[model samples]
Target: MPLSEQEQRLLDEMERHLLHNDADVVSAPSGDRTLSYRNLVYGALLLLAGVGALVAGVILGDVWGIVVGVIGFAAMLAGVMFAVTPVRRATPVTPREATSAKRQDSASFMDRMNDRWDRRQDGR
Candidate 1:
């Protein structure tokens, strides 16, 4: 079933309010830290290596095996930690850069939305 006219109007009002109030959120700058592809690759390799060590440990079946198994578990845990940790960006985003980037990316999108809304209102 379709929304009633009143429901549609209310929805439109809510959208307008959200767009107005949440423009900052929509255009928010990514902070100083981000995940590195290099780190992800390295972490994955470490994790695989850890798994191999763990399997070998199981096969050995002795005190040495226990030691290797513990080491492997530690490596796997470290790999996961390393993979998820975000690194600091080399160059910090200046205020000017942030503003310009945000405007360039989001202005056209916001303009398009506003234009569509205007057209919808005019049609009504």
Candidate 2:
């Protein structure tokens, strides 16, 4: 359900107050839990290599074949582990904070302009 304008305003105000009072609330870091696409691809490659090695090992029936098969299986297991691990990312900067910064800069510029105007008027 969509929030009404008054509810939205209240939420915004509460957020501003909370952010002002709590630095952790504003700057808290977040973590990304999804595995990256690159990691997925790597995992797939490892699995395929392991399967191929195992198949070749069965067909060749040699010591080197068994060794290669074991290595490939280990690689595939490592890839699976990597793919399952959660990735960490920092919390995103809020649009409200950015807008506030821009407004402050504009206000400062306007104050300077007003000061200059007052100085000129006083001189005249």
Candidate 3:
């Protein structure tokens, strides 16, 4: 069935209102939050290599070697941090959604049932 002219106008008005007032809701994976297992494995291997290089430098007791060893240790720290750190996933919160959530903070099942009953009574 087709909507009545008045209903169509109301729906169009509502669509316009929503388009103007509602924020764009997009769910996308940020590069930081998307950690692949392959990268993690590679990072772990890099960390191990870095630690070994540092240890070898220390054992050799050379100034240049020590510098290289420190560099390796820093690399190792970077790799380890990369491997251990988890991706932070966050959802973009819109003002309307925040307000609506706050408004319905404690709305329970019974509250919804009562609201439905009231609507039915009003409709009748």
In terms of lDDT, which candidate is strongest? 1
lDDT of 3 by residue, 31-112 (tens): 3454557669978998998988898888878897888799889889989887866665454335465446434432443375
Candidate 2's residue-wise lDDT over 12-98, tens digit each? 655655555575665543434434677777777877877787777777778988887787778778778766665654454465766
Q: Per-candidate TM vs. native?
A: 0.53, 0.44, 0.40
Candidate 2 contains a number of clashing pairs equal to 0
After superposing candidate 2 on the true structure, give the runs of residues whose Cα lies further than 4 Å from its correct spot.
1-32, 90-124
Model 2 scores worst on lDDT over the 10 consecutive residues at 26-35
- List runs of model 3 lying over 4 Å from the truth: 1-34, 85-124
Ranking the candidates on lDDT from highest down gives 1, 3, 2
lDDT of 1 by residue, 2-121 (tens): 999977865765565554558676434358877889999999888998998899899888999999998998889888888878888898755564455444545555676689899999
Q: Candidate 1: lDDT of 67?
A: 92
Better model by lDDT: candidate 1 vs candidate 2: 1
Clashing residue pairs in all predictions, respectively, total: 0, 0, 0
